[model samples]
Target: MTKKIVVLGVSGSGKSLIGKNIADKLDYPFFDGDDFHCQANVDKMRQGTPLTDEDRKDWLATLNTILTDNPTAVIACSGLKPEYRAMLRKGLDDITMIYLKGTIDTIWQRHQKRDGHYFNGREMLESQFATLVEPEKDEALVIDISQDASAVLNEALSLLSKK
Candidate 1:
């Protein structure tokens, strides 16, 4: 059966690229969670400001609604915090979080090379790391970001197909 999949990670972990590819392969709607951010949040990130949990609450709520409503779509989201992941899980079952795990250095390197992205590499790196609570009790498919995107997607798709 089709299932809701949240591709979770810090910035520059290639969640969007991989998630979109997986969604296309699976014939599911792909939603970039970044698109759900409000203008204020976008402005803050563009200005190198880190978002407080308060700043993200409403956005997360909206994501929850979208995911719940869609039932089985793919979402690329930085579900960095445990509580945030829990919030996403609320009122939803058959949801799987695929964590694209990587070191801060790797993430920063990727972010720095990103020419037109909103997030400031130096500033948000720390915040993203700080907010991160690694997937609980292996409740996710933790793929290394250093791997090839095709390989990573293959692994994820293999696992998801099993479920």
Candidate 2:
């Protein structure tokens, strides 16, 4: 069956980069979770304010719509909370989540070099990691991003192949 994979992690965990390669390898459409954000949300993050659950409510709804519309796509999202992931899972049963795991130091290094996005420096990273509720069930793949990107992607691909 075709799958809608949610590549999830805190910022700077390589969710976007890994998601892109996975989508390319699986021949699925790719979506950046950042693109689903509203300008207000973007502005808030740019100002270094962490998003409240209320702030993320509509954004999660929008993502649900996108995944509902394109069932064969792979999306890279922060999806820090289980509630947020559950929101994305609504109306979509054929979904899989890949949690790209990493340590604070690993993420901080990558975050320092990020460009052209609302999140700058280490503020959001701290908030995201703090908010993160790692997947604990069988429906999720907890792959550490501490390794090379190719290694992470390859492991994800192998898991997808099984599904």
Candidate 1 accuracy as TM-score: 0.95
For every candidate structure, what is the RMSD over all alpha carbons to the true structure, in angstroms?
1.2, 1.1
| Candidate 2 per-residue C-alpha lDDT over 72-95 given as tens digits, one digit per residue, 9 for 90 to 100 | 889998888889999989988899
Worst 10 residues of 2 by lDDT: 114-123
lDDT of each: 0.88, 0.88
lDDT of 1: 0.88
Clashing pairs in 1: none
Per-residue alpha-carbon lDDT of candidate 1 for residues 105-155, written as tens digits (9 for 90 to 100): 888878877888888757688888888988964678888888778998998
